[model samples]
Target: MANKIVVPIKQVPETKSVKMDEKTGTVIREGVDSIVNPLDLYAIEAALRLRDRYGGEIVGISMGPKKSVKALKEAVSMGVDSAILLSDRAFAGSDTWATSLILASAIRKIGDFGLVVCGERATDGDTGQVGPGIASFLGIPALTYVSRIQDLSDKLCRAERLIEDGREILETSLPAVLTVIKEAGEPRLPTLRGKKRAKDLDVQIWGNDELGIDPDKIGLKGSPTRVVKIYRPKVARKCTIAEAKDEASVGPAVDRMCGFLADKGVLQ
Candidate 1:
């Protein structure tokens, strides 16, 4: 049997278009449009491509508010074999560690999945920490910032990870976690058949109690870090434009700048 690949995604508020309250520093997400994260598209595409090549089922998982089903529907329309949404009031305000613990619990419930894939980070949080957090919670090997996944034989999986200085190639056993960056591949368009199938396909929705996660440890209570405040940065610009009409004026222009700096004590 081919290995089953699972990809978990999220629907986040379009922070790009969101306006914040300058006084409170809280996003005005109410009535704002939500969309499936761009990075998650790469993870979903990777799973589908692996399934097509290796002959397995590609399962899509997501966590968010009740409205987040829209995100999974989009995934289903992209040819995922099945979709699961984890939703509940208790899941609100969960940080990376708590969120990963809840997701890991759901993964265990699904059972028998050989590989897990995820995006490098979510645009909303920009933490880039959940993928590795999931791996740590599950005690599985995780290779993140993967730009390329070369091979996925049941024998082994080889991938190239992008680092700041260069790339690192890694090989890991089956049942490992792979976190893909957007550069991994261009996601495929949703097919008509896939859209039709998604119409009737009911995505399984899991709750905190159903997944058997410790209530206290799977939500805000479990998060250690809290943002004391959030604010938009204010930037001040100081620029000088210099012009020299002829070669003779170049020396004078340079001297003018030097004099300005010297008078300001910027140059000693």
Candidate 2:
């Protein structure tokens, strides 16, 4: 079988600076700097390295709003042979479980891809659930938290899986799904030639119907979970505004800060 590898990726929020829309209570991704989920970069790097060693096509697939094209472009600039954007308004509020089902459907339709790789989790969700979810839906074995690709062949592939305690070497068959960790490998820098190529090549866009996906099995209607609510972590700013003619007023501000931390159990 030819080595046709697919990497599933996402553009995730800047966890340190996330803001939520007041009305929707969902993350305000607009105007925020989104990065290729770091973990996915590892997966992509793994796929690219494999493709480089053994001749094959590296396909990048992502599902998100139109804005998510930025992430796909970055992958293309890293030498991915093909890319697919799966977007639909009907997929608005899908949680991990629903998202996995949609991706599983899309993967099934990709026809000849031999290996599928994904990040262990998205920085925003941190669910670490989607990779395995896709595996379950597709009825395939999944190896996750992969730190290194030990050895690979068309029929059998081996990897070093990172666990909480240490690591383990695991082997699985060709059609297996892999969820990679950041420790797997560093992602490659985009070359001038690769970037130019990415700019010219059109990324294929797929809708639910194009994937031959049933509405009842995809988007909101087919999703089994929902985002009941989303919100930003409130940051309390401490400003004295103390019209203090002298430095003495700093005492109240200091005491207030100390008390706040004490109440929050951040200080003893």
Candidate 3:
């Protein structure tokens, strides 16, 4: 099996406090509490498992503002061998396509990796496109929604993927990208020793200068998609109370319920 694995992670606003700037079509992260994307923890755990079994180095990478270093440190505390942060003003407002391109560039700089692992999706974006996008940029196979790694070798990887109906087993060449689902396993908490190591770790920070990405093709300027608008969905409900104080009223109450159901097309 390839001895070096790369895991791409994200820092996201706490779900409950997530907000968007309608004008800019970007998440409002200022003053918001952030944490390592929960789903990404599974990816970290999976990479750690692979490294433990195969004996390799696990490198964690993240693209965000300087504050995002927190997320990388969290990954390191969970046993990542080291971590790197991709931060720069030019990287602001990057969509999945641009984000993937930047990450792929970083991976290229850390070349000779055997595999790349990622979370199924990021809560803030709720889009699972980055994993496959990275694979496309790297010209490697992309295995998504993978719940388990059945087997691994220098030239091949067999995994169990979660599908709509059930699970599917497939094998792909090494140096592929895998988007891990929660079913893979529960992530472990950071141990005291790991925490100590992470505290002293000097995470590397790379920017556009290091990646040498074209300024016009690295952030909002490079994104092909845009959020035109965002609004809370209006949920309107009408409550109709049908009282059945006695047995004599039960039939009428039932009829009313059925009528309401029919009116709403719930009963066809």
Best by lDDT: 3
* Number of backbone collisions per candidate: 0, 0, 0
Off by over 4 Å in 3: 232-268
Query: What's the CA RMSD of model 3 in angstroms?
Result: 3.3
| Best of the two (2, 3) by lDDT | 3
* Candidate topping TM-score: 3
CA lDDT, every model vs. true structure: 0.84, 0.82, 0.93
TM-score of model number 3? 0.88
Give RMSD to native, each candidate. Answer: 4.5, 4.3, 3.3
TM-score for all predictions?
Answer: 0.84, 0.82, 0.88
Candidate 3, 104-157: lDDT as tens digits:
999999988999999999999988999999999999999999999989988999
Q: Name the runs in model 2 displaced over 4 angstroms.
A: 21-25, 229-268
Candidate 1's C-alpha lDDT?
0.84
Order of quality (lDDT): 3, 1, 2
Candidate 3 achieves a global lDDT of 0.93
Instruction: Give the per-residue lDDT of model 2 (tens digit) for 22-90.
Output: 654456677888888988988889998888777789888888888888889899998888888888877
